[model samples]
Target: MIERGEDWVPPLPTGERVAGAKRRSGEGAAPTHPAKRKAGATERARELRLDETKAEYRLWGELRGRHLNDYKFVRQVPLGPFFADFLCREKSLIVEIDGSQHAESLTDESRTTWLNSHGYSVLRFWNHEVLAERRAVLDTILAVLEGQIHSPSPGLRFAPATLSPVGRGGGASHG
Candidate 1:
């Protein structure tokens, strides 16, 4: 028989202390993720849900419960080291609502590229566009989901919030 030293620490089990182990789908309930996530990721997603922006709140109202063209959407879902603002698992799409601070951010560019390579299409809309031109935003989301707008690459298909909400100008246009 082998004996362990007093100073040795036991390995942790992934199935334990993780929120998904208990129940499913709610404020604190964690969805099963393919990528390994830090415990803080689950907590942060919950916190973001609790402290949603006005833009996020308004968008969620329309997207929740398969309301957008009968497509189901989940908010604050963990995607690797980041959290998607809104995600439709079925269509592999993510929607981001941004303010002026995110205008022309290279960080967002890289993030989009990474997410796209992982098979998720990302669409971003400015806060004002979401609040003032909500119907347009919803329509755009539906277009992408229905394949009216095709993204060859997520990063190239998006324009920064600095540009048109319709994203007319990008490195590459959706066909």
Candidate 2:
């Protein structure tokens, strides 16, 4: 993911591109909380629209209300100061899917910093991972969750772990 100003944005996968209608460029200017609208109304709008779009619907089918492995997840979950794509409240976990533009590393870094600071474990998958090999992505997410369940929290932070770019993946050989 890349950070242009403040938001951490992930890359868009090659084949699956978000249409221009959905792209919100120059979004850095929008306040995280727009003072003009009441907070409840904004939240309700987000909630109501969750299932109104294809991407959200597909993701909801995979994750809503324990749809996967009976593992309960709340959609459009509000955590800390932001909304999570999928959250398991019991585990304090967040799952986010990044698009192609996030290929620039900075965006992911900022997102990690925020999530880590909030005592949440975030697992991110590239859009391609979700689109091309969803099973693999799911397996990785499950493994992370299982590990967290067994161990004491390490208070992990996503501070520049060495990564092999996607196509060159050597299985994320970490330091």
TM-score of model number 2: 0.55
- Model 2 CA deviation exceeding 4 Å by range: 1-56, 148-175
> Residue-wise lDDT of candidate 1 within 56-131, one digit each (tens)?
9999999998998789899998765468899877667789888787875545655564455455677888899999
Q: Which candidate number has the best lDDT?
A: 1
lDDT of 1 at 3: 51
Among residues 3 or more apart in sequence or in different chains, the pairs in candidate 1 whose N, CA or C atoms overlap within 3 Å are none
Question: Tens digit of lDDT per residue, candidate 2, span 1-175?
Answer: 5333222222343433222222222122222321122235455547545444444456667776676766777765543334566776555667766565756644445445544444566766666667677677667667665663333223222122222122112232232
Candidate 2, residue 169: how far the Cα is off, in Å:
38
User: Weakest 10 consecutive residues, lDDT, candidate 2?
Assistant: 160-169
